[model samples]
Target: KHRWAMYIDVSKCYGCYACVAACAAENNVPIGVFRTWIERHVTKGGTVIFVPKQCNHCENAPCVKACPTGATYKRTEDGLVLVNDDLCIGCGACIQACPYGARFFNPVKGVVDKCTFCEHRIYQGKLPACVETCPTGARVFGDLNDPESPVSQLVKKMPTSRLKEWTGAEPMIFYRDLPSEADL
Candidate 1:
């Protein structure tokens, strides 16, 4: 069983929006909806910080709880939160339940949509498009079950925090050197 996780070094992000563009293209995300996005935080001192936001793929996902049907669920094998489009009722509960504001109702598909860590590519032994295209290598993905994985190794050495940690969703996305202002 591969417990997957992502490591994002906030210091490395350049706010190029390359990851954002790549994710949208790879996932075929409809216009006005995004599977991944970058948030810019500008301090009064003129310092700018870029934080990449996406589905946390939470361990105790509120979206899964909010769904009237079992459309939103987490994969036990990889710990990835996923949606069953056929089971979706187009209800906005999942979207509202998400504290990170990562879920969206895709008008084109008539179902709730969000990031899946690009599992389509992961299962094929390829990295997610966003991770592959990031020029600064800010984002890293790996199986946390493997101690030798880069994400695991980095996490052991870095001071990592999850977005909205107080929510107790147990988000799998870990951040290093994140700015104080960036919450999600």
Candidate 2:
């Protein structure tokens, strides 16, 4: 089965906002709202860390199930949960359902907006804008179903984890070398 996943190596991140700006420009994400954002985490050892944040594309997506207008749905081909703008009612229910606070209301479009995993670029067999523009190659995207993929290999070779695992969202994104202060 084809599946979607993103692996971020925190050790490689250097507080570069490349991923943030790239995603915004590619997706046309509105101003004053971010589809994704990066947080700076500082630990007791005086070690500062950069953590990129975005939707987890949960297996049991509460955002998808909570949309009253049937706007949010998961792609069967790649498992990227997306919103249908035309069908969206701007109820903002999904925004609350997301534990990571990844969803936001777009004042310009008058609907809820969240990450689409760059479906536009992915459909062209190209990487997401953020992943493509990452200078450090910190963000890795691939079909996690393929054991040979770099993301799969990293998952196998390292102790990685996702956010809010107790929520049972079954997040597809993984993080490695995360400092305890980040706790993502």
Candidate 3:
């Protein structure tokens, strides 16, 4: 009954790329590809902000619907969108369907891969590598269904935005303190 979610304080991110490096090491992501990455945006007024990007783990994920096989799925328990390597054909259908550009074909695994919010670590009662490694504490993760959880509290208290809301993917990743001028 847990709906896991992440809240990113965009203003806190300092473009250190620690989260990016942690994600790559923890997830074994190949070179030249990333499960999570950072985007640096400068406003017209000359303010810079770093936005961390990854799978939104949408409630209505287009990647799940686009999969020819049942490789891509959303876990009902925690709302984690995942890929089953055994079922994956690397057809790239899911990649094309994702408006966020979160998926990629893994040459090492020969299957589609993406961020799972570090499900393996989370189930072990640990934070996602990105969240744990973030020097500025920009990322917060927890069960959104829990009223007392940090993620839920932040979402309730702050003005937040999700990317590509027009696509209706219902992305779970929320951005706090996102500047309006920063191009998403």
Better of 2 and 3 by TM-score: 3
TM-score of each: 0.97, 0.94, 0.97
* Predicted candidate 2, C-alpha RMSD: 1.3
lDDT of 1 by residue, 33-111 (tens): 9999999998556789899989989999999999989999998888999999999999899999999999998988988
Q: How many residue pairs clash in each candidate?
A: 0, 0, 0
lDDT of 2 by residue, 1-184 (tens): 6787899988898988988899889988887899778899887899888998898899988888888888999888779899898999888889989888999999888888888888788768899888999999999998889999888888889899888788888888999987767765
lDDT of 2: 0.87
Residue 77 local lDDT, model 1: 82
Minimum summed lDDT over a 10-residue window in model 1 is located at: 40-49
- C-alpha root-mean-square deviation, each candidate: 1.1, 1.3, 1.0
lDDT of 3 at 104: 94
For model 1, state the Cα shift of residue 26 in Å. Answer: 0.7
User: lDDT of each structure?
Assistant: 0.92, 0.87, 0.92
TM-score of 2: 0.94
Model 1, runs deviating above 4 Å? none
